[model samples]
Each structure stands twice: as structure tokens, then as C-alpha cells.
Target: MSKSKQELLGYQSHLIQDNLTYFKPTRTSTTVTFAEEIRSSLQEPKKSISPKFFYDENGSKLFDEICTLPEYYPYNSETEILQSIEKKLLPYLSNEFHLVELGSGSSVKTRLLIDVLFKSQKHLQYFPIDISEILDQSAKSLCMDYENLKVTGVVDTYEKGLDFIEHYDDKPNLITFLGSSFGNLDHNEGMKFLQRINTLMKSDDLFLIGLDLKKDHEVLHNAYNDSQKTTAKFNLNVLKRINEELGADFNLENFEHHAVYDEQKGRIEMYLRSLSEQSITIPKSDLSITLSKDELIHTENSHKFSISQIESYLKESNFEKLEMWFDSRKYFALVLGKKI
Candidate 1:
């Protein structure tokens, strides 16, 4: 583990039986300023920004809405598979393992696994890690619901959170990275992340990951470019975020959301395409850039995987495949494995 800009801010929730502690970040040398990241990204010839920035308050709300859209299948499909197979997963779980989740947004789907873990144990220790303050509310709710469960919520990036926890306790961990968040990383990045997790785990520690599977190009396209244009709004909000936070002059209407499934690449590419030739400036970043008509600023990529591809990823990362649960349509997968 390496040093990060993250520091632990520990506090007991008074409303509960002192069962919840939340860790908030404080400044450190490793912190990267948003302005600097935006400037560098804009200077790239590809003109792309990391999708993680799509989570400004408004963007997060919009994304929550997107999950409910009829055209969006990943959330629903994954939920279906989890509900169907959660009990079946119980036999594979260790008797006394720390329950941890990475990027644990709202912990909506995680409740299934958490509920299952409760079946065998009277008291449990759970950790939910995410960068959002939403974890605060989620932690409180879960604490109230599970009186005997102790929750340690970490508000930090996945890497820093893992670093903190790797040193905190020695209990074998059943860590999960759900909601297909891993798809945001390309193959190399995904492998590297998994390797880091492998380093954190001891033998027989468990991992559960959600992945969207390869499917028809049209289905993928519709999912990201819904008729209601919710995904469009979600995609364009990043530029709006830049304008508000980085002091950028970006006319929201001057760009349009564009998402298309690249069947050859087995991914959905999202972009904000310039509607016309325009110049933009960000005062804080000291940046000015010009875009030609239809010029794209790459935003996100949702990579869909095949079983073989996922198997190779796990095996290469030193994970022994345990089981993979899928929906009837096979549109999504929940792969469970053990660190070797």
C-alpha cells in the first residue's frame, strides 16, 4: 500500500448504538486538483476526460434515474441474477469474513448478499467504500436496519480505501465490486485493479464482481441512447459540471450526447460531440480550446465482456473461479471467486 491524500475521519453515529464510523478524506501530497486534471485531459489529442467526474451531485441523481429507465438493462438484469442466486452463494462464503464492497453506491443490490451473510452470523462487520457522501446516509440506514452490524464507511477512492483497510484488520474479506463498475476500466486497467485486490487478500478470501455481458449492438445502443434522452442528459452533464466547478464557458446546447455500441470492440463509447465550431475557456485551468464541428470529447466506455474474457482476467489475477451467476437472457453476470 502507498500513501494517499486520504486520512481517516472517525466518528460514531449518535443516532445508532455507536455502530457506524465514517472515514472522510483530508488533504495530503497525493491529491490531484480537478483543474489540473481537466486541463491535462483537454490538452490530449484525443480530448477525453475520466468518467469518474460524471458524479457531481446532479450527475449522480440523473444516473439514478437512468437506472430506472426501461431501456437500461444492466441494473435490472444484475438485480435479477443476484436475487435468484444469493442463497446459493451462501455455502461458498467464509464463516467469519469481513463484508466489504468497493464503489458501494447506495448498497441497494448489496443488501441481498448482506442479508445472506446475516443468516449465519448474529453480529457482522461491514465496510462500504465510495467517494460520495451518499455513503453517510446509506451507512446510517443500514446501521438502523441491522442493529448488531457494525459499519465502517470510507469516503475515498477505491485504491486509497483499500490501502487503509489492508492495514486496519486481519479478518479474511469477502470484497465486492458491483454494478459493473469494473466495466469502466479497459482490459489492462481492470487486470491491474484486480491484481491490486489480489495483493490485499489472503488465501481463500472471496471476490464478487458484476459485469455486463456482450450483446446485440442495437440493445447496447438503445441502453445508452434511450428514447427519453435521459442518458443523453446524463452524458452532457459532465460539461455542465466543468462550467460550474472549473469556471469553464461551455454552452450546454452547443454539445450533444452521443453513445454508440462498438460491436468490434465490445463496448459502448460515450462522447459529447460539438454541435458546431466553437471555442471554450476554463479560467481556473487557464485553458482555451477550439473544437471543429462534430468534434468529440470522449467521456466514458462501458465494456461488455464474454465469459472467456472474464475467466482469463480472474485466472491472470490469481483468482480461482468459484461460480458465475447469470440472468435468463445472459445479459449480465455475477462472478464469484476466491483469491488463490
Candidate 2:
């Protein structure tokens, strides 16, 4: 007799019950705080919005689509680099360490490292920290796929996750901040972020980081302004988030996505350019703003780095650079550092 589908998949309940634990802050950032951030950001003379705001459910879905576009080389290049670095990383991988990842969206690239670590160890512990509830599904899938793997997920900001990990002394950890999310912050902010991680890490604990490398201007430009307009959609979705969650009336059509590689700055700058003069109101904050024709609201900056800069950042943050790998085209990098 054939078994029912439920019976065939019944092990998932056990996996969730026994192998997975999720930690979320009792009070996550509220919509009121979000409204205040929006108000404060717009009030700036230059007019801007935090790129961190661009990950509401819809924005995240749009970004996932953008990643598949032909012009988005960072995601693809970083994945390729990870695929080729397993053997070289073996010296640092062992049964005695835990894997902790920051901004582990979908965890597609992490699976490669997991496979590498499993070669030397029978069981593994993984902690993926992110603000999205995708943590639940990622933990469930990982637990079911690897019988010996256990998962502890944290749904919170990077700082909060670091605070949590600082208390977890079960074993040395290989903490990872991947997918060039580090580039999202300006230099000072990035330095402070790395320092905080350094403080949370034990001596000689591993730190793996992925970064987008400095490349030709054309390549950088195309990567953010994809031909499919998916990148545009992702950028505009931030406006949609403010509209729905912050009670703002933003005519998405009146804003156009603008991305350009600023070679002098060694970064790609993304902005939402107002098509014409327009006044927008947000009821949540009782804020009103006017934008002149072609006025720009800076949305994001993705800073590309050279190897020396990466080494400098790691060293300044009290880490010793262990090794670095790159894709064939040198379009992205994976650097492994040890806490000093």
C-alpha cells in the first residue's frame, strides 16, 4: 500500500520541534519609529532614505528577482567564489566550531560551506541572524536536509544578534557577514560594525566576509541598473513600503530609479529621482516634503574595495587576515580572517 503524502513528509514536525530554535527580540522596531526615521531622513538637506528600510516583504521579493537578472554580477560572482574556496578553507574548518551568519537571506551560499564543514564533522551547529521571518523557513529546511545539523535562528538587527552571540560560549564560532552587505554602510559605520563583531568573537575565532571587488565602471553601472528594470522595481519598492506602513502618499510613477557608478568614490550610488516637482505627505508623522524636478533622494551606496583596503579594515578591527579568494573574473572576494 502506498503511504499518504502527509506521512511521507511527517518528519518535518519533528525537525522543527527538536532541532530548531528561533530567538526574536521581545519588541522589534515599531512602525512609529520607522515613521520617525523616514521623517528625519527626508528632512536632511540632501534628502535621503535608509537602504535598510528596503526589506519589507515586497521589497525583499523584488530584490530576490533582481538577483536573478543577468546584470547583477555581485550575487553570482560571490556564489562562484564560495564554490571554489572549500578546499582552501579546510585548515580552518573543524568539529569544534559553530557557524554563525549575519544577513543570511535564503542561505543559498551558506550551504556550500556547510557541505565543506560536514566533511570533517558528523554534526554541525548553525545560527543565522536576520530581521526577516525567512529565518524560520531557512532553519526548517536546513534541519530536514541534514539530519545531524541543528539550527538556532535570530530574527533581529545585526547589533542585537551580536549581543546574543556574545553570551553564547558553547564553542568557538565561525562568524560570517556575507553577500557584500558590509558595503551598504559608509566607511565609519562599516568600521564600527566590524569592531562590534570583533568584540563578540573569541580569540582566534574565524570571520568570513564576502565583498564586491573594484571593477570596470561599465560593469558596476550595469550591475545596479539592470536591463530588465527589476533593479528599478526593487528601488521603488522602498517608496511603496513607506506608503503602506507609514501612511505616505508617494506616487511611485513620479519617481524614477537612478543608478550610476561613481568611479571617483569607488562606489555605485542609487537614488530615486523625482520626475517633476511634487509635494508628498505622510500622515503618520504629519510631515510634508516637496521635491523639485529631477531632485534626488539618495537610496543606497555599494562600495567596492581593493584587497589592500579589505586587509586594512580587518586589521584595524583587530582581525588577522587568514586568506582570501576571488572569482575567475576577480569581480568578488571571500576573505577569511581570525580574531586577534
Candidate 3:
């Protein structure tokens, strides 16, 4: 059977009700308006919004497009590492494993891992946790073809720290944190994030992490600031979202997308800059904000890592590195660790 048909056959009856709760937040305009009010008020000096907020339905679609662009090396590089190292990674898995994925957007890169795991083990249960509700349908529909796979999705942010941990019975888990999404958090935040995952797992459970390695500034800069301009549109879409849902009068034309490599911070910073001094009104909050020409509203940050840096992080989080794989250019890495 084809993947789609298989998905239909394996579709769980309970998932329909589950997805209702997932889609509830994004359907109402009130949530969007409130989010805008919170965003505008939070924009103090040197302020920034978390990229996790950028995964609304539209933002999620835009991001999927961004991954396909030539300039975005992280997606392709990580996919390569997963595909090439799948055979070796499969041996580490014992029987009847539960596969839990963090930030499992569309499970695009995960298909490679799933294929390998199926070959090694007879039955598998898959849990994909992501903040975007739209991904639940996409992930469930895609994984339908695998007979042994049962997919339960969580639509909460990773910062919630394992809100859905009780969904699975006490079974050995092979958890995956893919796409270098871990890079979104700073060093201290990353350590805490890993420690949280460590606390949830049994001593024998395995964890796989994908990390984008530190590369040339030019290359990293181009990846975020692509020539195709899709990333720019993706950045500005936040404003479009605010305007549509919050009854805000934001002139998308007045703002330009800006992304730069901050050498001192060692991260890629994304901002939306006003072309001229302007005042914008948000109807929901009954507030107006003034902006100076070239003034920026920070949106996102992508931090790069080195192998040694990642290893040190794992140690601090009480995870012992079992194995690691890297691409030829060493621009990306996949590290497998277990609770120490």
C-alpha cells in the first residue's frame, strides 16, 4: 500500500478529537490579537520575539518553502547525515521502541529515520511533538503507511518541558531532536532543555540530536538571508499575520527584512526594519507605537555550534555521547547520547 492509503487505514479514531484541541487556538482571532498585544508591549529596548511564535499555519508553510531553497544548507545537510548514517544508527535500538521527536515539523527529515528503524525492528510507536497544530494532520497522514507506527502528536512549545510525557507507557524510547532546532536556545537554555529530557527518560533510553556546526560567516549569513528572498517574505509575514488577525494597521511595504551575522554574539539575528519613521496602530490593544527610520524589531536568532561545544553541552546535561556522524564539510552533526 502507498503511504497515503496506509495512513488512512491506520488512522486512529481518537485522533480526530485530539486534533480539534490542537486546532482550537489558531482558529480564533482573539488569540492572534492577544499575541500581537503581547508582542508590541514586549518590544522594549533590544527586545526580540521567540521564533517559536513564527510557526502559525502560514508561517509553517513559508518555513517549509525556505527549507527547499538552495541557500538553506542546514535542512539538506542534516537530511544527508540522517540518510547516510541510518544503517549504523539502527543497531543502537532495541525491540519495540517508542520514537519521540521534538519540533517534528511535517516529519520531513524523519522519514529517513523511520525507514531505517522499520528495517531493524518489528513494531514501533512514534510520537511527534511540535508547537504547530497544522503539523499534526500532515505528520499523521504521512506516517499512515507504516503498519507498526502509531503517531501521537503534541502541539505545545518545547519550552513547556515535556507536557505530554505521560502519553506513553513506561517503555524504552529513542528520542530525536532534529533540524538543529536546539540551536534556537542559548547555551544555558539548551542545557536546561536537555536536562529536562534526561529527567524524563530511563537510564537506558537513547537521544539523537542534530546540530548545525559553525561555518564561515558568509555561508551562515547567506543561509538566513537568501538570494531568493523567501526568507524575507517569511520574516515579514509576522506583520501580515498581526494585521490580519489583530486588526492592526501595519504597512508591510514600509518594513524591510534584515538579517545579519552577529560576530560578537556568534548568532544570526533577524529583524524587521522600518524604512521611515512611522506610527502603527493595533485595534485590539487600542495602542500606537512610534518607530524611527531604520529602527528594528527583532524576530529570530539561529546559533551555530562546534562538535566540542556540543560535546561539552551534553556532558553538562548528564548525557554521555555514544556516537556521532557528520557530513563531508563537517557543517552539520548528528550526535547520539544516553543518560549517564
TM-score of 2: 0.91
Rank the candidate models, highest TM-score first. 1, 2, 3
Name the Cα RMSD for model 2: 6.8
Model 1: pairs clashing at backbone N, Cα or C within 3 Å: none
RMSD of each: 3.3, 6.8, 6.0
Q: Which candidate achieves the best TM-score against the true structure?
A: 1
Which lDDT values do the candidates have, in the order given?
A: 0.83, 0.82, 0.74
lDDT tens digits by residue: candidate 2, 115-174 = 888887888888888876654455678888999998877776777776676565557788
Q: Which predicted model would earn the best lDDT?
A: 1
Which TM-score value belongs to model 3?
A: 0.87
**Candidate 1 structure lDDT:** 0.83
Off by over 4 Å in 2: 1-16, 27-32, 133-136
Error of 3 at 10 (Å): 26
lDDT order, best first, reads 1, 2, 3
For model 3, residues 252-328, the per-residue Cα lDDT tens digits are: 99999999988777788899988999988777656667888999888887888877888899999999999989987
lDDT of 3 at 101: 79
- For candidate 3, list the clashing residue pairs, or say none: 6-144, 7-144
